[model samples]
Target: MALAAAAFTAGCGGGAPRLASYVSPQFGYTIPHPAAWHRVETDGGRRVWFLPQAPPAAQPPEQTAVDFLVVMTRDDPGPLPEIDVRRLAMSLLPMHGVSGFQRAPRGNEEIAWYRFELTGATGGREWASVGLLVTGPKRLHYVVCAGALERWRTAQKVCDEVLRGFVPGDLSR
Candidate 1:
């Protein structure tokens, strides 16, 4: 299944690039990303980062551009209610300097998930991001897709595609 997922690619016409699926056996989740993106995993698969193929040439050598998608998972004490999940998502906003925050709830009665769209400035650079927080039976999953403000349109497209393809692991396990 991993090999098949790795081999599968979806082409987008009119100059749009193709994408490939990244399946993490350790985490039991899958995310779609551009073929050229660089992937990094840490904390025993608790966190994963995906960066562009290369930093922009105009970027200062000392300051690498902060554009990437990150997925993080942590063990929760137990199941949490929708209100708690929403509060948790709201709490994360300030930490990221997030503004223009908008939230949308997802999932059925068994799972509590919240999605947020926000714009923020960090290190003097403006950026935009889409964040998702989900509460499972025993764990919480968070995914953040962000990019530079100037390139937000293109970034948002990729972010949308990534979100659409994201499949969380079986939290009941």
Candidate 2:
């Protein structure tokens, strides 16, 4: 975990362009990622995915599982609507080897989520990923899950930990 935190500090605090404070944020929250993961800053924003060298077994050995990609905008008004999200999701299916997608909701949020079932090479054959659209006080959360199929479903508790931790940074801070 130490390595993971170090990676985040180095990756997010280093000489990247200073991002202007988000304006009128709603769910603008930040979670101090645990020490075992790495912060992957994408064109969208900062992301945290598993360390490349971490063994696959390090994740829960289940049929399907949850991974995270939380995004906070410079301004958090709210999440995009379902129609837009669904369209956006469909756009990504082709990129991640997804054959197709079915739109759905994630709790109270209007999200167009889908799952991908593929083969896992390490004797696990069920692979799935879920796309979620979350609106908060200062950020829009997107959780794209990747894991073994059935196992991911059962790992809801694990994923909830990620969801429940969302907290808006002080607008004053």
Candidate 3:
């Protein structure tokens, strides 16, 4: 598979890190992430996680300032109702303290896709996430990028970049 290089700057202003594409051979989807981040896969490639490197020692270990992205897919049983789709998306998120739910502008008319943003408290830490659910012909692609609310503005930029670059389905094959 061919991986394209892209430049991404996290936070306000600093040197941009080069990004590399990650193609899921098993699932047939691809996304780009900063080269410095670590990748972890589980559930036989059904779920993938992109985690940033360890934080500086100056940061308190207990300070749950987390930033990461997770991509997951499951078999889709054809198209679903709008309410059902919204329900499915909400079910994937934290059960409590969720708000600011709004559907993102649509793109790609062929497949049923929903993009949204929400904030919620999980594990006593507030987080902001941008999530996408694409009901493809054969699979339901769910991608979410989240970060601590304290740094949400910066994290949202990176999350948007990752979400925009995401392409569902196996394009490499």
- Compose the digit string of candidate 1's lDDT tens values, residues 4-36: 122212245433347778887876878887776
Candidate 2 local Cα displacement, residue 3, angstroms: 17
- Which parts of model 1 have CA positions greater than 4 angstroms off? 1-14, 53-65, 90-106
lDDT of 3: 0.66
lDDT of 3 at 25: 81
Candidate 2 residue lDDT tens string, 1-173: 33322322233453211122222233345543333443444334433343312335545222112233334233334355555545554453223344434443433343223332322322334445444444433444444434334445533333344434443344222
Q: Rank the candidates by lDDT, best first.
A: 3, 1, 2
Comparison by lDDT, 1 against 3, better one? 3
Residue-pair clashes per candidate, as listed?
A: 0, 25, 2
Which is the winner by lDDT between candidate 1 and candidate 2? 1
Report model 2's TM-score to 2 decimal places.
Answer: 0.42
Q: Which of the numbered candidates is closest to the native, going by highest TM-score?
A: 3
Candidate 1: 10-residue stretch with minimal lDDT:
1-10
Specify the highest-lDDT model's number: 3
Write down the lDDT that model 2 would get.
Answer: 0.37
For candidate 2, the per-residue lDDT at 90 reads 46
Measured with C-alpha atoms, the lDDT of residue 77 in candidate 1 is: 48
